[model samples]
Target: MDAGTRNRLRARLVSLRDELLTQGSMNIPPARTDVVSTPDDDEAPLTHMTQAIASNRNRERADRLEQIRDALALVDEDPEQFGLCEVCEEPIKPRRLELMPWVVLCVACQEKHEHEHRSPGSRKHLGDFQ
Candidate 1:
């Protein structure tokens, strides 16, 4: 990739890192226990469920942030490897990079990777329910 394009991608990744950090800092405070527990004490479970969902969402974002940081490191350490597919060692399509700057695989390699990584039974059962 050109120096200009690399810089642009780095800037975008930095922006994304900031956005993820800002969004992931949110939390739902625990339910209060001042009032006596009652049969209708549904607030506790509902609050717990809400907190679980938020935790999961934040975790996903955290994972993505970590990936972005790693990509930045790769770009810094080896500029030549920045746009090459990890699996094929070939230049990834510029259009694919535009859509997913964090991707480490080209389209063909990604499809093969996904197929191998997925559960065989899941794909074999596509029409069983019908």
Candidate 2:
């Protein structure tokens, strides 16, 4: 990649790292809470279920934030490596990097990976999904 492009990607990586840190910090507090107390009433069950769902979502977000942080660290250590796909060892497209600075996979490898590992009930529509 050109020097200018590398500089732009580095700036974006730094921004993404900061955002991930902020989000991960926010998720940590709620994640430490004790499980909701079991209740005899139906309303309590619904509330508990909602809370559980929220907790799961937070956990997932936190995990993603960690991945983003790691990716940023990799970029800082060796910006050249950021241009390669983590899974297939192929060069990532410049446009892809421009669009998602933290991405670690090329378009073809990413699509293949997602196709093989995506959940059964996951959204299949391109527009509705990432």
Candidate 3:
């Protein structure tokens, strides 16, 4: 990438990191204490589910923040290698980089990596559900 493009991406990463940090901490809902008091309450499960969903969303945000930080570090430490695929050592497409500046691999290598890393039996055949 050219110096101009690298600078632009670096700015974007920094902005994203700041935005995530300023978004405030997770607001996980407290577990329902009334579940025992009213065993017939239909809303108890809903409360718990809301808490779980909030926790997962926060976790995802945290992970994304970490990725942005890593990308920024790479940009700072190795300016020459910022846009190159980690596996193939080829320059990632400019459009791809624009869309996801934190990605470390190009499209082909990323697809291969995901395919290889999938757990066994994670995907079931359509007939399995029949």
Q: Estimate each model's TM-score.
A: 0.75, 0.67, 0.83
Query: lDDT of all the models against the reference?
Result: 0.78, 0.71, 0.84
**Which candidate's TM-score is highest?**
3
Off by more than 4 A, model 1: 28-49, 120-130
lDDT of 3 by residue, 1-130 (tens): 9999999999999898899899966797666555566533687788788889888989989998998999999999999999999999999989888877998988888777766887887664323432
- Report how far off residue 40 is in candidate 1 (Å): 4.1
- Local error of candidate 3 at 17, Å? 0.7
lDDT of 2 by residue, 8-105 (tens): 88788777767766755322233224578545475666666677777887787677777667777776788778678988888888877777776888
Rank ordering of all candidates by lDDT, starting from the highest: 3, 1, 2
Deviation of model 1 at 20, angstroms: 1.2
Better of 1 and 3 by TM-score: 3
| lDDT-better candidate, 1 vs 3 | 3
As for lDDT, the candidate ahead, 2 or 3, is 3
